[model samples]
Target: MTAAHCTFFGESNPETVQSMQGCMRKLKLMVPKLRVQKRVKELEFIQHVIEYIRDLELILSEDESYTPHSTQISPISPHLDSTYRP
Candidate 1:
């Protein structure tokens, strides 16, 4: 039996970078569900994904040489409040 592991490569290609940036921009446009705070699990999941995407954006922005698409890295807008208790 053989074990498998997943690996992630930092994409430096101009076209792929542009596509990823576009997808991230589109993700930011998503609207939260009505009364999302009521759903604790869903809210937590959303927060986790948002944090991950922000981390990815930070990595992309740090590579100044790969900016064939756009040099501007806009922060994702906050759709949910940080201090919400269920």
Candidate 2:
């Protein structure tokens, strides 16, 4: 009895097997770093939102006539650029 293996790259080739194994190892290492970077971005976005809210609160408290169209730019202004009028 014999076992058969098939791949686009020849299955019996040691070089192909080692190259694939190296690629897999590199991908495994990158996955966690990618996750950490994604999480860091999320935290940064949350921080920006918090700061924007704080600025809004300060403006509202300082001026009874505060409006969304006021001159002050937000920390998250890029997101508001499309919807904000002023």
Candidate 3:
């Protein structure tokens, strides 16, 4: 979980950070739906998995904040915002 050598997220940028925030908001909104699972064991596992993913996200964010990403690769096009869908 070193800040300078993140292996999971690869890189960060304005668009990528924005998208991740948006997706996280959407996932939180879906938590209630997860509570309706008929099997308790399955529900617990699903919740654990989601928590694990969120933990990774936290690590990624912290890494980006504490390290320099100026040399990292970014796929976002500065010219595509006007036509981009997501």
Candidate 4:
């Protein structure tokens, strides 16, 4: 049967069939590369978070002031008391 007659199975013409075949070819070409690209992106994101955490650790370790208000006190103290105070 002609492609036009095959429309009873699905609403597809000759041009639509050709387009679908092209899309399938493109998807076959891209799927593997897309997966690799996604993995690279995830690794980059993890690296960025690791670097950010490292920088944050350095910032927290170094004695610095982060006073937001007059009543605000430093969370980290050089001296640790025997009792834990909230």
RMSD to the true structure for each prediction, in A, is 15.1, 18.4, 16.2, 21.0
lDDT by residue (tens digit), candidate 1, 4-83: 11111586777766665555344434424323333346456467557655655665577687575876876644623342
Colliding residue pairs in candidate 1 = none
**Which regions of candidate 1 deviate over 4 angstroms?**
1-40, 68-86
Global lDDT of model 1:
0.48
lDDT string, candidate 2, 1-86, tens digits:
11122232546477767666565444333233332332345455445445545654665577677676789764633433233221
- Global fold similarity of model 2 (TM-score): 0.30
Cα error, candidate 4, residue 32 (Å): 30
Instruction: Note the Cα lDDT for every prediction shown.
Output: 0.48, 0.46, 0.48, 0.45
Could you tell which candidate, 2 or 4, scores higher by TM-score?
2
Give the range of the ten consecutive residues with the poorest summed lDDT in model 4.
77-86
Question: After superposing candidate 4, which stretches have Cα over 4 Å from the reference?
Answer: 1-40, 64-86
Off by over 4 Å in 2: 1-40, 66-86
- Per-residue CA lDDT of candidate 4, range 5-71, in tens? 3333474777877766565444333233332343445455445445544654555457366433558
Q: Which candidate wins on TM-score?
A: 1
As for candidate 3, its clashing pairs are none
- What does candidate 2 score in Cα RMSD to the true structure? 18.4
- In model 1, the Cα lDDT at residue 60 comes to 55
Poorest lDDT segment (10 consecutive residues) of candidate 3: 77-86
Q: Tell me each candidate's TM-score.
A: 0.33, 0.30, 0.30, 0.29
